[model samples]
Target: MDSPSRRPDRTISAMPQHTPPAPVVNDPATTPSALRRHLARWPTGVAVVTTVVDGRPVGKTINSFHSTSLQPPLVGWCVDHGSSQLDDWLAADGFVVHVLSADQIPLATHFANRSADRFAGIEWTAGLDGMPLLVADVPLRLECRVRHRLPVGDHTYLVGQVVDLTAGPAIPLVLQR
Candidate 1:
């Protein structure tokens, strides 16, 4: 019966140097970039919310997505008030949220760029209420109808009631910074 107290000390010469204490932000910075830097440490999954605007497919890459309810199956994400497709999303009949796979960084980057056409070379199909849905193989896809829209500060939080969804056994893309 060997006990921890009886165990031999295995310390070798100067292995694993002591790490410095993490930097602390005592007084929260006032700049927007400061807030971004503070929040960059928290990892989040990436999602592309798509809808039809002026008969064209519109989409945006966002990390602010979460499941608000299970029985009613409610999901929500936030969109910046300065987004060009704000009005389109607000008036959209429904939208689809695509959970990108771990290897889908290109797709996420394309959607994140506001200057690109977004869907010019992308493969997608029409979804519920004529909303645009990416055809790429992803981790999960949710078809949702607009449930609520609330303006908060510089962003608008959009809530959606998931009417249908599909999930797969795969890793999802996560954003850290």
Candidate 2:
């Protein structure tokens, strides 16, 4: 019997080629609903990004706050593009990032309200450059000065250089969505 190795008709070109489908290009605006749903799965700590404008205190509750750098101590948070207080926050000399305690959900809710006076019944003190620091017995507080501002999509990313910080024994408030 002739060995199969003696066959010469077979060649590498005898195999069929397969091509992958074109990648899907989805517009960001078209998928925001899904994106939002996906993002809600992530858990984050809550903070009130506070600053003083002129003679009064102003702030907004946010979970977008995070540390950006270690050297020179940088931190950041995002403000909505259409926020009324965006200008005040950008113009302020300094601001404070109050990392709320788990028991301070009321403080977070208070700041989240747009129509309410955030500091009306809340007790707070002035931090660096007289920026309002909510005295909610939080786990951590950072006094920072705006270092950079970048407009991205529907939000303004504000990066601040930490000037001072304080930490407490309280547990931080965490949230999902």
Candidate 2 ranges beyond 4 A from true positions = 1-30
- The residue-level lDDT of candidate 1 at 137 comes to 88
Query: lDDT of candidate 2 vs native?
Result: 0.87
Q: Candidate 2, residues 1-177: lDDT per residue as tens digits?
A: 768888767656656778987766874635868787778799999999889888889989999999899998999999987887888877877779999999989888989998646788888888888889887788999999999988989888899999889999999999986
Instruction: Give residue 80's error in model 2 in angstroms.
Output: 0.5
lDDT of 2 at 64: 92
Tens digits of per-residue lDDT, candidate 1, 47-121, equal 899998678788989899999899899999988888888888788877899999999999999999977488888
Q: What range of 10 consecutive residues in model 2 has the weakest lDDT sum?
A: 21-30
Overall lDDT per candidate, in order of appearance:
0.88, 0.87
- How do the predictions measure up, each by TM-score? 0.83, 0.81
lDDT, candidate 2, at 125: 86
